[model samples]
Target: MKRYLFCEYKKTRRKYIFVMAVAITAVALCWGLYGKYNESALKSGWMMMLYQLPLLNTIFMPLLSIVVASRFAGIETSMMKQLCSVMPKQRLYDAKLIYSLSIILLSLLIQFVSVYIAGRCFGFSGRFPIELYALYFMFTIVPAVEIYVFQFSVSMLFKNQAVPFFIGAIGEFIGLFALFLPQYPWIRNSVIWGHYGALQFVGGDWDKVTRISTFYLMDINWVMFAVSILLCVAFYFIGRTLFVRKEV
Candidate 1:
């Protein structure tokens, strides 16, 4: 596994996967932080972030995964025939998925650190909830993993990277719209792309009259969260099997 992983890393060194991911993360962070500089926003900045970041994640993370997965798979579209003779298809599939995830995870951690720093710099009131942040990380990444699996599978199956990219773009719009439709919990839970919004643990209340905003903890949708993890696992096996059986 390590050998396969190392080989993937080497192959992708020139692909700018890390660079692109960092750029995407920065964009999302900036979007989340914009217009949040007012006194009211700063006072409840931590909770505001908790409320807003998942929405950003729903918009950006799937597209990030799509780009990264497409790049990883793009390098192999013409070379799969050669690669299969040299390595087991399953090993290759696993290595690519694991390696791509490592890149995504690091990108997310950087985003978290950036948000923390921003909170400190801007002096967000209220104590930082380390436990909630940890759960936030878990909730955020699990859905990303599920999305990555779906993206990677499509990337592997189709030589045209645009197919997966198009799917990702459309999925992002669907997921973003779904966030506003909270009345349908089942819709949010079932859409893999919207799980970030579905599992969000924080909710914000804004007073249009007074222009006041307050944040509160919402119930964690554990059932949906668990369902996401299961989807990731199931997709991994299903994708791997299809890739192995697929003729190179």
Candidate 2:
């Protein structure tokens, strides 16, 4: 199993590094360049970047997931349908899920580093709160795995990649933007991850009867973490079910 995954890692590793580097470079340049307007612009850029970090998941994860899953699927697509059906069903299903998830974890490690670099460049005022960044990595990784497993299962559902890729793209776009609609607070709490990102730091600055009307919300911290875990479990089985029943 280790050998098989390592081989897949070798084949697909470039995409992870390339995508993460691009995201980090783009984020840094956007903030670094926009910082020239004024000191406030720089500060706002920093704050904005912090709030928008979760947006990275939506922007990069989907296409990355689709590309990785497609690569795995492409390899297995050549096998005869009967060959898969007659094999040890558990091992066959496990191989696909394991390969897809291993790549997802690798991509996530890159994202964690990239986001940390972006945070530092934005200029941390304090010790950079290792715990906060750790949670950021944890929360972000849950969704990354969800997107990867979901896309992998979707790819297996159809031989064609276009439809699954499109669906993943559309789903990610909606999930990223849900924070903007403050009126629909349920969406803000339940579906939107940026909500956690905001409360994580932005809470400190929420001025009462002043410029920033928002404040720290500690109410849903446990719930958000729980939901992320739930998503991981939910998608694992979902992908497993799809793969187990899928035709070769």
Candidate 3:
């Protein structure tokens, strides 16, 4: 498993997926910083940073997952068929899942570091919300796992990367619209792409002029989190079954 994981990492790194994910995350962080600077009356820049991270992740990370998963699976479909033939199909599927997850973790790490730096730069004051940070991390992972599984499945099942890539792009656009449908939380929560916004049940309110935090919560949408995990697990098993049956 280690050897297979290492091999996938090398191939994925060669594809520049890691670089692209980091670059995209950096851009998102920069955008959040820009927003913070322009809104002077905002209370708790740290809270804003935390709130925006999941939104950015929702918009960009799924697409990143699709691209990375496609490139990772492309190896087998393109020229590695013979090499794959020598291995059990389930092992290959598991390796690909792990590789996709590693990319997700890398992206999350970049986001976390960037947010911490940006919060400090913005002069956020008061106790660091360690509990909130842990909850944010958990919330971020739920959607990420679902997106990775859904996109990775499509990428592996179909040899053509364009199919999954387009699907991911479309899903991202739809996710933006999902935010406005707050009246129907279930509608948004049901889709993998919308899980980011769904997880943000707790949020912050700030004064328009003072920008000082007026209200915030260390709470979350537990139901959405649980549903997302269940869906991710289901997707993983279904994808694994399909992948094992797929012709190399």
Candidate 2 residue pairs in clash (backbone atoms < 3 Å)? none
lDDT value, candidate 3, whole model? 0.77
Q: Which candidate should be chosen as best, given TM-score against the real structure? A: 1
- For candidate 2, give the lDDT: 0.59
What's the count of clashing pairs in each model shown? 0, 0, 8
Give one digit per residue, the lDDT tens place, for model 3 in 98-155: 9778877888877777777767766777667777787788888878888889999898
Candidate 2 lDDT, 152-228, residue by residue in tens: 77777777777777877776666667746655656645553333432333333545565542223233366666766
Better by lDDT, candidate 3 or 1: 1
Candidate 2 lands at a TM-score of 0.72
After superposition, candidate 3 runs with Cα above 4 Å error: 36-42, 204-213
Q: Provide TM-scores for the models.
A: 0.97, 0.72, 0.89
Ranking by lDDT, best first? 1, 3, 2
Candidate 1, residues 151-187, lDDT tens digits: the string is 8898888888889899988888888888999898777
